[model samples]
Structure formats: C-alpha cells, structure tokens
Target: LDFSIDELAGNVATGADTLSIALCKVSAPTKEPWLTLSYDEWICVLKGRVLVHHAEGTLEAKAGETIFVSKGERFRPEFPDAGTEYLPVCLPAFRPDRCIREDESDATVGQQVNDMHAKLQVAEVLYHMCSKEDWEKSKADNAAYFPPMFDKDGFTHATSVPSLLLTVANNFYQS
Candidate 1:
C-alpha cells in the first residue's frame, strides 16, 4: 500500500492485523514531521538523503542506511535538504491500538527504547533477507551511496547454510 505521513493521519483505510510494505518516494523539499507508530517499522533508504530523528539521536541515512522504529516512539523522517526514497515495512499491521501520538510528556519511556531496538533488529533482518550474492552486488553498485561500514561480513558471520537455504526456499516459493 502506498503511504505518506499525511495519508496515515488522514481518514485513509488501513488494516489491523495485516502487514504492509511500501516503497516511499519522498520528493525534494519535503520533510515530514514527527509521528509515532503503532506497530514496529523497518526503514531503508533506497534513494537520496534522509534524516531520522528519535530520542536516541538523529540518524543521517543514505541509500544503504537501514533503520528501525519501535512501536509508539515519537519519530519522523526528514529530507535533510535533499529528496529521498525509502522502503518501509510495518509488522502486526499498523493498527490504531498500536500507536500513540506524539506528546511532550508521555510516560512510556522504557517501552519506547525496547521498541526502537526491536525495529532496528527487524530492519537488519530484512536487509539480509536477499541472497548474499545479491546483497553483495547491490552493496558494490551502491558503494558510493552507502554508509562507510556497509559490508556483507555480518551476513556471513550470522547466517548458517541451513538458515540460508530455508530463506532461499521461502523466497523462491513466495515469489
């Protein structure tokens, strides 16, 4: 489903338990305001420059910058003086019950931190979901656009042969 922060806050149709993935194309000169999520979110910038602001700090993300946002944390993406695009996946489907709108004096601080960690983990998982070869190819092609530490060493260290096989089979069948 296509989405922008505006559509999300507006009276648009949304699913409760359904997960949604979208490629967001942020136009030049656009900086979305701070917004909170109901479900965990994974964000990976695919084009241009993007800026993410959270309680932890501001993360400047480019093509290879992957980010995770836990449910209920007040966060948002800004263009940072350049247009950008991103891929975002929402798990447990972004239901209203899962989101708490931004407030200056919210009480749920600890939960937000946990959620942020969860979101980042999920983003890392998705980043490596593609085949190692494919991942490497993209990494090379976009080396200039990627962060300095962009490498597939982590994938090699983390994935077992059986796990990779399962992932490949699942992706093949699903596709």
Candidate 2:
C-alpha cells in the first residue's frame, strides 16, 4: 500500500479472538513511547530502521528485522534514518483502552494496573531482557523491579523458555 509522510498510516490486516496483525507505515521520523496492558506486540520491520528505547535500553532494527516488546514493557520507538514500513502482530488483539501512552494523565498507576487485571488473568511467569544501563539504574535507585511499560495496565509481557524467543529473534532480529 502507498504511504504518506503527513500521516501515520496503518490498517489491520487480519484479526482473531487471540491475535491480530496490522500493516503500519510511517513516512517521517517520529518517536512514540507506549505500553500495552493486555497484549504482546511483535514487530517486523519491512523497510528502513527503527530504534526502540525501553526501560532497560535501546535496540536498533532495520529492514527484515523484528522486535518483540512484551506486554507492560514501556518503550519509545524512533524511526530515525528514514521512513519505515512494518507489520505488528499483537496477541489477544489490540484495544485502544489497553494501549496507554507514556504521558497519559487521567489514570493513576494503581488504577491502571487494577483495571488491567480486572479484565484478564495471567498464569505464567514471563522473562524480559533489558539493557545494562537500565539494570544499573534500578540498582542505584534501590528498586527491585524496573516496572514494565504496561505496569499501569496491571500485567507485564514475558516469554517462557520454550516460547518462540530464539526462533523469532533468528527470523526477524538478525542484522
């Protein structure tokens, strides 16, 4: 599909009860920091490059690269070098109410978390990889947990050992 620099363009390609896929086209450089409370997002970059900055650190992905941002992980994605086209596959479908912007002011952190859990239940432990900087910062702050982006949403995204972690990385995250 065609894209325009004046707008952020995207469309849901397909969706099911548990998942959905969307094609996103960004024609200009931009940065958006966001957290998804109810679902996980796996992005496959088709063209250009994007730098994703998370609580832990930053990862740069270019064409044919993929990035998985677990639920509750707060991250700011910057399309820096050029416009980008990507596909975002979200588990459990993506909803506006569950996607919280970093600067959103209406809900308190506690309320957000409560509301999120009220809607869904999590039964498994997930793992997330962070940058050394974020780890060090947490230590200096004497905080045991570096809250995920969707902490406000009440749940965080994680990958079990047997999940598609390595396969996904190998398939999409390779330089």
- Model 1 TM-score (2 dp): 0.46
Best candidate according to lDDT: 2
Q: Estimate each model's TM-score.
A: 0.46, 0.50
Which lDDT value does model 1 have at 140? Answer: 80
Total clashing pairs for each candidate: 3, 7
For candidate 2, the clash count comes to: 7
In model 1, the clashing pairs are 38-98, 38-99, 70-115
Candidate 2 residue-wise lDDT, 108-172, digit = tens: 43253344335443326545555588778888999875545445646443344436455534553
Off by over 4 Å in 2: 1-15, 104-175
Q: lDDT values of the candidates? A: 0.54, 0.60
Q: What lDDT does model 1 reach?
A: 0.54
lDDT of 1 by residue, 1-175 (tens): 1123322321122321346555566544455446777778888788876778888889887788788888778886667544567777777554334565543453233243234334222222322234566668767888523322247422222222334555644653352
